[model samples]
Target: MPLASQPAGRRERNKQQKLDRITAAARELFAERGVDEVTTQEIADKADIGAGTLFLYAKTKGELLLLVQNSTYADALAQGKSEAASLADLLDAVMAILRPVVECNRKQIDNGRTYLREIIFGDPEEPHHRDAIGMTVQTEKAIAEVLQRDERVSADDAATLAHIVSAIMFVSMAATINIAKPVDEIVAEIKDQVRVLLPK
Candidate 1:
């Protein structure tokens, strides 16, 4: 029988199981050792799968990195969109999304700060590396549409504002939260900044 003719249910189940295992393992490894330090073989070992299985799920470590980044971004934005009203409301929306992610994975985030920093401020040419660039553009465009509806900003200005907000979010993620200056205080500061930026 040809591969296409073979039963798909079992294959699908096995594929899902493998994906679950890999994703779980990657989360654990990322939480424990950070993203840069983890290798595909190590991830496979943690997931109890072969190196080949790792590639089946993610073609490269970069793809897996993108997966993690996108998931985090999507969750933040979804939460933000649901909760925001004004620009300050939007800041609160963003902070709500970020606080938990940062608190839960503070160590991992600190460890991976360099990678996150590079992602935000590094060369624009890096987007040529993957489809994330396009996805990011889409996200910014969506935000721009929202802004255009609420304010008098031009389309280009709206998109640029979205990018600036995105940059601020990145900076917040990179910051260290401590007793001297708590996350709430930082968030309030961000909210104040947004108020200044948004038109009356």
Candidate 2:
């Protein structure tokens, strides 16, 4: 068989190895120092990659955060969807979907705030910003799928509902944290506000 016909395991492994090196270096540095304090050159040196190469993975420190949080966010979304699958009600499904988001944000609330600010208000010209936008859209699509499972919600309506629900959850979580409100109160208040937006 030709080399072209072979499985791409080697290629994939190499890519994974590089990514692992970068992520491992980032984890150690970010943990020991913190995001704001860690310089890109330091991370690049630790990863054994050139400074220019590091930018290929993440253009800015905030984007580097997006890179680090990528796996965690994906895992949270996966778990949220899985749990939401067990519940039939729209509200329950929505809450299940967002609960993980809240928990993930709480992991490093300072980073969370910066992450939100950068992604939410970032320039669209940046690649990482585009990725963040894409992630949000995908999350909303997942929510729409759940809501659409209900007979009462038309396919078209589901998209709108998902947008509303996602925005509500996003804003709610940010507010709850910033105001020093009891974190425990977020879920209940979100449920109330969502119920208000979507009358049952």
Candidate 3:
């Protein structure tokens, strides 16, 4: 019976190893040359896996980008949350939460824009897309928690303002006119909008 369980565990481990390889390959290729220039075949080759196996992990290039970006986004959010926790001012705390996220997105500008598009237009039923959406929700929740620190803000108002802040961040990141803008410029734009949204 233990031997039977051993085989299942091995299979699961193998699956995870393949997934890790796929993620690493995609991350490297996407970083070096934006997702638009990177091919699935190249990623599969880098991962030493077949194209079929690559599809088994992510059905499309967009999905592959999602798989790659989601991890970075999560790390950025975690950093933001930590930084926000220590700030006393509401605007500073909110910017602390948003700055890392904007930096993460703009690391590869085209890829960042593409990732945002995929998050808006990708198939929600897909696991990677779903995870991307979950990241947004988590980001909002983090901001809302920060908002609630103000005695005047109700829980519902905090949540609503957080949603608006998330929209401002995403729109600032995704807008085509801002494509050439520096990360700091984008962060500043978001900060300006978010500052207005916060209670006086």
Candidate 4:
């Protein structure tokens, strides 16, 4: 029985190792060249795995991008949440929760836009897409917590405002008209819109 369990444990480790390699390879390639410019074959080669194995992890390039971006997005959200904890001002706390996200999204502009498209239009049933959606939910939850810092804002209104803020952030990042804008400009635009929505 112990031997049987050992084999299972070893298989699980092997799977996780492959996934880590795939994620690292995809991240490096996507950063060097946008998602549109990187090929699946190149990712597999970089990961030291075959194309067939790659598909077993992420069936499409969009899925692969989600797999990579989701990790970074989660990190940014965690960082923002930590920073927001110390900020007493509502606007500053909210921006603390948002600034890192915008920075993460703009790291590679095309890749960022593609990740947003995948989250919005990709099949939610797909594992990577689901993970990406989960990240968005976590982000909204973090923002809502910050909004609630204002004693005048009810929990319900805070939630509604958080959802709206999420939409604004996504749109600002995805809009083609802002493609040439720097990260600071994009973040500033989002801040301006959010400032309007906050209660006086």
Candidate 5:
């Protein structure tokens, strides 16, 4: 049988499958080798595809890293939304959101720390800033709605209060810790901070 005998649709599907394989290989290499060290040719060899073909899917190694990071964050956010309800539920939900991002980015977060920091600091030309702001806005809106509906919270300052509290939680968790503490202890302190933001 001739190699060209394959149907056009099959060829396209096979090409897409190879691209998927390349993407997966790239992600693993990035995770292991760090974003700075991994090369497109290395990813291609790992995927058992030609280096030229890898370029068809990604222009550069940076794009592949971004793709992996974005997909990881999206999955985590979707899972967090599914598992959490109301402001009270967000403590764990926020943790859940961090979980996958942290897991997928273990090398970057643990060894580099720059990757996670970039998301927070953001680049003007990059979408990270907009994405972070949108995520925060959505979470704030949810918190604000919850506060407005709660008898213990004042409706007048619901949105403001929500944003303030949410910012505090995110900052506090991401902040540099002089002394490492248990997760529960940290959450307890954060919960106290949340209480401070709420009406007495």
Candidate 6:
């Protein structure tokens, strides 16, 4: 068989299993002790992997957060969209899709206070960062779909609205949650913005 035609299926499966173990370990440690307090060697020990091997997967401690939280962010997006479906009004729909993801980010907000932006928008070439960007695109697509349900909005307009909504969600969350301000008030303000931004 050619190199490309080889059944590296078992090898690929093993690789994914190792990655799962590492991510699981990272998640547990980060949650228990917080990200800043946990070390890579501790993670590797928990995963039963070598320290060097752990480094191969995540180059830095920050990347480890990305690796662990990537699936969580994706899950929050999925859950948010599902919750958004029952909401008829555009403001409710938009906020439904945003709240879970916002709460998830808030968990790490303490340690993430400094590099939250970098964590959200990571280097595209890296694995965890690429996953982060992919989830973001998924989120934007969900928002566009929500907007599309209303016949009043054109597809182009809905897409444009989704883009604006995405930025607003990020900025609002960052600004409001950064200073330990009220998320509820921020969400209310965002609701007003969406009301005016979208057409009836």
Top TM-score model: 3
The TM-score obtained by model 4 is: 0.95
Which parts of model 5 are misplaced by more than 4 Å?
A: 1-23, 33-66, 86-108, 111-113, 127-129, 151-156, 178-186
**Greater-TM-score candidate between 1 and 3:** 3
Tens-digit lDDT track of model 1 for 1-200: 99888777987889888887887887777767777788989989989999987887777665565545555555655555555434444445445544443443244554346445545544454432244455456556655656676557888887787787656645665665532455566566555665566656
Q: What does the lDDT read for residue 171 in candidate 4? A: 100
Error of 2 at 123 (Å): 3.9
Q: Lowest-lDDT window of 10 residues in candidate 2?
A: 175-184
lDDT tens readout by residue for model 6, 70-183: 787878898999999999987788889988877777666644432356556667788887877777788888988989888988889888998898777677767744457555
Per-residue error (Å), model 5, residue 179: 8.9
Worst 10 residues of 5 by lDDT: 105-114
Where model 2 places Cα greater than 4 Å from the true spot, the runs are 1-5, 9-15, 31-33, 176-183
Report each candidate's C-alpha RMSD, comma-separated, in the order given. Answer: 5.4, 2.9, 2.4, 2.5, 7.0, 3.3
TM-score of decoy 2: 0.83
My TM-score estimates for the predictions, one after another, are: 0.66, 0.83, 0.95, 0.95, 0.56, 0.84
Each candidate: what lDDT? 0.61, 0.77, 0.95, 0.95, 0.60, 0.80
| Model 6 residue 188 lDDT score | 69
TM-score of 3: 0.95
Candidate 4 per-residue lDDT, tens place, 1-200, comes to: 56766555688889999999999999999999889999999999999999999999999999999999999999999999999999998888999999999999999999999999999999999999999999998998899999888898889999999999999999999999999999889989999999999989
True-structure RMSD for candidate 6? 3.3
> What's model 4's overall lDDT?
0.95
lDDT of 5 by residue, 111-158 (tens): 223344555665535554455556556656656765665576566588
Better of 4 and 6 by TM-score: 4
By summed lDDT, the worst window of 10 consecutive residues in model 1 runs over: 98-107
